[model samples]
Target: MPTKTLRIPTTDGPADAFAAFPDDGKRHPGVLMYSDAFGRRPVLERMATELAGHGYYVLLPNLYHRHGPAPVTELPEYIGEEVRPAVLARLMPVLEAHTADRVLSDADAYLGFLTAQPEVCAGPVAVTGYCIGTLYALNTAAARPDAVAAVAGFHPGFVVTDAPDSPHRLIPGLAAEVHLGIAEGDVTPEIIGELTRALDAVGLGHTCEVYPGTVHGFTMADTDAFSAAGLKIHWDRLLSLLDRALARD
Candidate 1:
């Protein structure tokens, strides 16, 4: 796979992003990968490269580009449980600033850049996200129903909140096949039933599961909550969704 640093022109400005694609000259399906609140980092880049090797052009953009390029706020080389709260403190404000309006605006710009690429095939693409990043993926799928074919969210949050604008509300308009890997501690029988009922009501295609024994950040390698099994499960579910939704000749 070949990886490169690039810029996605947004309504805000040129947002710095990373891209990974197969070395072969042929174009492939496009996958937009959104990072956790940690924003872009080596872990995200490696994840993008691994996915690109599987025959898709994966693009990882800075979700907090409004403040600045990724690492929007400096982060520790390793984020352990002891420092997790402080990190979330610094990031929450920036993440909070990304209102739904801003997310939808940025999605249009990012999707335009992705679909316009010579290395990307002509068709609906996929969007994969982790942690709070899942909200971005959901918004993109809803706002650009024509351009997004699948959505994979790992340890997702805020999808079924009481807020009128919760991400689940966006499901009715989405054409994407959805997969949501919910962290164990984040859900109860009630939450699961609520979320599932919403999906069923819309007649949307989806797979929703609570990853057993995994905490909120189970898929993040640098966190104490990281679970090897959960990470592998995410990869399995995510790739399957992409393979089926973005299948091509």
Candidate 2:
């Protein structure tokens, strides 16, 4: 595998990002991976590399580039119990600043750059995210129906928020296949019902399920909530969706 630190040109500014792709001289499907509120870091880089190894050109951009580059805030090497509060404190404002409008604007730029990359296959791409990144991932797929082929999210926050611009509301615009793995206990039955109804209204290919016994942030190995079984479930679902979507293109 090959990795590079790159700058992605966005409407807001030049976003500093990290990318990984197989070293083999062959173009692969592009995957735009959005990081959680924690921003781009080692855990995300490792995840991107793993995805690239599975035959995709993975790009992980700093969603908070409006604030600064990667490491937008000084995060502890690991988000342990003691440092969790401080990490959230620094992350909350950035999360708040990423309004729906901002997310849509950045999504346009991200998909544009991703599809244009020399290493990427010239076709529809996949988008996946964690936590708040999930909101952006869904919105990105909805906003660019022609470019995004699939959208998958894990442990997403604000999917059921009171806000009118919540990701669930935009489900109708999604032209891509959708897969959501909700954290066990994070989403109530009422919220799940609303989400499923929204997806049904769209009449798109989709699957929404709660991973058994997995708490929020289950895919992050550095988090206390990490669940190996749940993470494997996520990988299986996501890769299958990607294969179907990318194969169509």
lDDT of 1 by residue, 150-204 (tens): 9998888777888988887888878889999999877677867877887788777
Q: Please give each candidate's TM-score.
A: 0.97, 0.96
Question: Who wins the lDDT comparison?
Answer: 2
Residue pairs with backbone atoms closer than 3 Å in model 1 (clashes): none
TM-score of 2: 0.96
The TM-score, computed over Cα atoms with residue i paired to residue i, of candidate 1 is: 0.97
True-structure lDDT of candidate 2: 0.88
lDDT of each: 0.88, 0.88
Question: Per-residue lDDT tens digits of candidate 2, residues 32-68?
Answer: 9988888899988999999898899999998889998
